[model samples]
Target: MRLSFPKLAHLDIRRGLMMVLWLQVAIAAVMIAGDWLGRNPPGAPSSVPGMSDPVAPGDQRRRFDPDRPVPRRDAPALPPGIDLPSTYPDRLTFERKTIEGFGDVLLLNGSIATGDADRLSSYLDGASTEDLPATVALSSPGGQVIEALAIGRMLREAGKNTAILPGMACMSACPYILASGEQRRVSPEGYVGMHQHYYDENLYMPAYFAVEEIQRGQGRTMEYLIDMGVDPGVMIYSLTTPPEDIYILLPEELLDSRLATEMLD
Candidate 1:
């Protein structure tokens, strides 16, 4: 018969296992804390890990709405040859950015909110007195009625041409911007929509003044259409459509209504 060592107690074995488990849990918690601290080092400016700059409120372009603001989602898939610019300017208003490969062309993709005209003016001021962009590629869902008019007028005066490339949209007050273009073109895969301007729910203007202001804005737009060689009657589509809904004109309708000088095939 061989002598046997004393057997370990079950309670003692369980306690040892529990101690190991607790040690592992503590180690895991320390590791997690270390990773978090490394990512967000003390005294560093708060920022998204991957973003170059801090996100700004109302930074994204959106569909124009009298009652609410809806951010624009990424555009739908487009034809292979269409090139959308990737560069975004640092400003918060409607701005111009050079297309990466196309030096002469510029992208204006944003809402035409208040003070946007001033922003545009500053962009134009960067150019020589006689020289300006050859083309202004547009992708917008529109914004403040008066601001859009101001920006459009500036575009027209400068004789800048405009286009909505594939997978892009130009709607609401955007059509006014398009009209201001000396030569307006719409891609078959692009969209151009229109709707009436209603009283902005966020504003506190009197109802009578709101109505009068809208009428005045409409009249100015009609005159602008005439000046741009587009038919003033196109206002009919805008006047009848509710502000909340858009009337996307068909390719043929765009031509017939004179909203587009030509459709890119």
Candidate 2:
């Protein structure tokens, strides 16, 4: 039987209200999904400094065109009171020194060239037989990037502290090694300068190779910072500085980057 006009009108109103409620639910669902995606977008790096959240296994990496012009870095000022090394060191040497109050400390001076990490390892092994150093002091003009990185890993694994002691300098890859310290200290008279990674000596290296090397080193450094719980933002200064000059971090900048947990008086 056909419904009365009044009953039909009532039925229509109910159906309309139900439809509106369903539409509202659908909109809310979409919004929730959008927010989730924004936080864990495909191929996006972690926004939080010193943390790595790898992309899900199935996520595709975003690739950029190779022909794009790469950005250039400006020359940075030499660190105050530091003179660039006239030449790479003949060799890296590890010295055992005793500080007046700090007890035994290992001193790493000169260039961090190839085989330097092996030398450091041998030193540590021999020293451990007697007594390990309370801290490893760095004073170098910097050298091989990979050697410095290896040295840093060894320091971290050995659970030793690192420092730029008074009347000393630590520049270039030295800062990377310094980051491995369980505790890092910088004396007022100490220096820690930073610069972009130097992968090759050839000035006319291919752009593609240079970019590739830089990206590789950048990834390693970022990972190292995260592992050490240090803020990777410190790299901003390094990346901006050309390989020739140095970017000396002010006291506040050093503290901000967590590079110096304490500054000795």
lDDT by residue (1-265, candidate 2, tens digit) is: 9767885566677798998999999886776666456433677563321101122222212111111101112223323433434443556777777776566677776877889889888888776544677688887777787788889999999998998866566777878888889999987556676777656644344444468777887888889888886899999878866453555566677788999889877
- Clash totals in order: 0, 0
Would you estimate the TM-scores of all the predictions? 0.62, 0.64
For model 2, the superposed segments whose C-alpha errors exceed 4 Å read 1-88, 200-204
The lDDT leader among the candidates is 2
Clashing pairs in 1: none
Steric clash pairs (candidate 2):
none
TM-score of candidate 2 to 2 decimals: 0.64
How does model 1 fare in lDDT? 0.65
The most accurate candidate by TM-score is: 2
Task: Give the per-residue lDDT digits (tens) of candidate 1, residues 120-193.
Answer: 88878786753566677777776776677788788888878888777677777878888878888888667776
What's the CA error at residue 183 for candidate 1, in Å?
0.9
